[model samples]
Target: MTSTTTTGQERKAPGRPRNAQADEAILDAVLTLMAEGQSAAAVSIESVAAKAGVGKATIYRRWPNKEALLIDAVRSMKGPIPELAGVSARADLIAMVTANRSSRVQEFGKVTACLLPELMKDEQLRQMHHAVMEPRREVMREILRRGIASGELRADLNIELTLLMLSGPSMAQGLFGTETGVPLEEFPVVLVDALLRGAAA
Candidate 1:
């Protein structure tokens, strides 16, 4: 696998002996800095090194550039999305969405909404964005799979497209931040219910 390396010479594979402590420091710094933007957040490499309390060399060793570093930082910040196991598709979707609506995951979502435009400018950042989000996508996929097995969803339903449909309300209205405009919780519930009715056997 390719990596963003600062030392041109290929010494060893990245993440081989990953330091959990340093990863935490970097991720914490990212959440704070991204939320702070250019204000309290320092864009300078020196500032990040100081804040992380790691040698500048260590930071450079892991990242190719500032954007690469920022991307990795955010990439490491993801956590498991909540799931309502052993439930109907309708119930699972509602429960999972409700969990995210009130959890820190929503904060990252808020962060993504604010940073995605800038992230799109850099190819590395875009990949990082995808890497960070891939797990969440899988989470939804798992939920759909469960729903299908339980006979709560259509046998021929397109999982990917259906996932998008499930997420429409959150994406359109900005579930937590409301920058995209607020959508009522009941609206998501109603929409999901309608979807269940349509997809049900």
Candidate 2:
């Protein structure tokens, strides 16, 4: 069902400038379909074009191919940079890892662990992932920066490498993360305790 009118507040009201709604619809359809575990490659632009009710040009105008499109969809679904305003950096960091559903993390993990290697060979795909992941990664970096500044964390810490170390265990649980046999509620606490102890002032 395609509508001619836009759907937002007065200023932003004309939500989709140019069939933007259709583009959004296309992305939404792709996510809904991909969630069923379909390989991103097996999905076709024609299908998305049809689903979004826009011409194929519309999709390509925004994304060159399925991978780019999928990455965009993933970025759209990205949750707010997990943070606890005004809390201790330690508490904020713990909330960052714990507040969200690990299942979402695992789903992303499976895609990254499996698809990334294959995509790595393609420069376009690599850049696409960077474009998608960079903003979110910056959020974590900022969190660490705040911790370092406030003396809750050691300044000598390698924020970049530290990110991997901090996120490693949570991600290492593999494909289904929780299926790694760790309990749901315990993940953030265990990860926080370990990471904090290592980085503590």
Candidate 3:
């Protein structure tokens, strides 16, 4: 005699089919909430699932947890790293830093800062943050390396340290400098000029 599997007990498919539109919708929903300064406490799977117009199951099928979903949303804020060639190192660095300070990136950074305490306590969240940030860091290293090679920057300039110097202020501002997200009008200009001066060969 054949046995029957009860409801919610049947062997599920290995996985549900991928849905591109649904994925985009979910990410957009997360960004929308973050840009509005919604607290992490308010952003749960149930809420995002509803905002995305997909079931909670769909979200779980992809992310398995809230942190993973949030990480992906932050990573998606950076569409593609722009080409860093075809310009002077100073010009390139300025463009790169300014481009990253765009409205969407700033919004994502602010949300990340807001969630920093919790993220720091969790290994998985820290790993995801590194994974998202490492590529961008590498790109800046390449630019700095080029600057050194071209005699624009000091030959002994430490790439990693310089990257930290350039990016740290904006990140701090997002985290603690302002509540309304101050405009980076002269921030990039002032920061870049100071960095180049210190590193100039």
Per-residue lDDT of model 2, residues 151-173, tens digit only: 88898988988778766665567
Top TM-score hit: 3
Q: What is the C-alpha lDDT of each candidate?
A: 0.61, 0.62, 0.70
- Give the count of colliding residue pairs in each prediction: 0, 0, 0
Task: List candidate 3 segments past 4 Å from native.
Answer: 1-21, 31-42, 176-190, 198-201
Model 1 vs. true fold: TM = 0.58
- In order of appearance, the predictions have TM-scores of 0.58, 0.63, 0.70
Ranking by lDDT: 3, 2, 1
When sorted by TM-score, best at the front, the candidate numbers are 3, 2, 1
User: What does the lDDT read for residue 58 in candidate 3?
Assistant: 80
Least well predicted 10-residue stretch by lDDT in candidate 3: 1-10
lDDT tens string, model 1, 1-201? 133432121223346445656756765666666666652234667777777788888777666678776665444444335545655777777765664454344555556566667777778667766665666677778878888887877788899998778766565555354553335545557667877777557
